[model samples]
Target: MDQKQVRQRIEEIIDNNAIGILSTVENNKPYARYMTFLNKDKTMYTPTSRETYKVEEIDKNSNVHVLLGYQGEGFGDEYVEVTGTASIRDDKELIEDLWTDELDNWFDGKDDPKLIFLEIKPEYVRLMNGRGEPPHSLDL
Candidate 1:
């Protein structure tokens, strides 16, 4: 598929599955964490704390990877792997707007000063289906 189609598919997949694995590099080693994400205007959002290791790793290296999919038994299943650079935003307005009671699970009901949002703009993505064959990739 073309870049536009790939982007559209990725957006659809992300919209369908709000949870993903966000991977970052720390000390040249891969660090992966599960995150609940929001997508808007081509940007992906996830709440995180500034004091967290993921934040520190992103500060040193903005590169990040995201894996999104559902584990189920059947055909026509979908999955995506997105690679991008992340930016940390501590804007209270944005954070407040994105924050929901559901987010309490991540922050324990305390909106700590160190808590912020991670904005990811994907540079490339690879999409796969249940067939488990070579994935079609798009360069953004």
Candidate 2:
């Protein structure tokens, strides 16, 4: 698929899914965790605590992988994988803009200094359709 198509597909997947499995490297080992994410203007946002292991891991190694899709019992086969470098942002305005009641489930309504936002600028993405064989990839 073309760049535009890839972008659109990624947007669609992210829009449909709120949770993603984010993979990061820690202590020279791989770590994966489920996280709620939001996408805006092709950028992925994940709110987390600064004290979280995943946050520390990302600080040590910016390279990260994100998988967003629906995997139900005998359901659709849609999936999207995004690989990129992530950075921690402490901008209060950005954090407030992305904040919602749903986030209270994680941070318990605490937006302290420990609260941080991870901005993932995707460098590559692979999108798969339902029961498809060949997947479409885009390198940005």
Candidate 3:
């Protein structure tokens, strides 16, 4: 697939599965967890608590990975493998902009001091293990 086709597929997958596994480097090892994510333009956003271990991990190593679009069982399941740089932010404007009532289940509303967002800026992405001939590389 070409870059444009891959981009559209990536967006489609992201729209289908808002949840993905976010991997962070911790002590030179990978620690991953399911996270609810959002996208605007081409940037990926995930809300997290400042107190979480991933915050420290991201601080130590900005490089991160996210696996999205996998839902059903087993082989050839469609997904996007995202490799990016991550940064933790406490911007109130951004928090408000990305906030949703569903998130209140974890946070004490938008102004909660612990409320923060992890911004993942993708460097490379791939449409992996799908119904295709080979993995398709994508750039954003």
TM-score of each: 0.84, 0.87, 0.95
Which of the numbered candidates is closest to the native, going by highest TM-score? 3
Ranking by lDDT: 3, 2, 1
Question: In model 3, where do residues sit more than 4 Å from their true spots?
Answer: none
Could you tally the backbone clashes for each prediction? 0, 0, 0
Over the stretch 84-107, how does candidate 2's per-residue lDDT look in tens digits?
A: 999999887898888898777767
Cα displacement (Å) at residue 92, model 3: 1.1
Better candidate number, 1 or 3, judged by TM-score: 3
Q: Write the per-residue lDDT of candidate 3 for residues 59-93, one digit (tens) a residue.
A: 99999999999877668788999999999889989
Task: Show model 2 residue runs off by greater than 4 Å.
Answer: 1-3, 73-76, 108-110
lDDT of 2: 0.85
Which stretch of 10 consecutive residues in model 1 shows the poorest summed lDDT? Answer: 105-114
Query: Who is ahead in lDDT, 2 or 3?
Result: 3
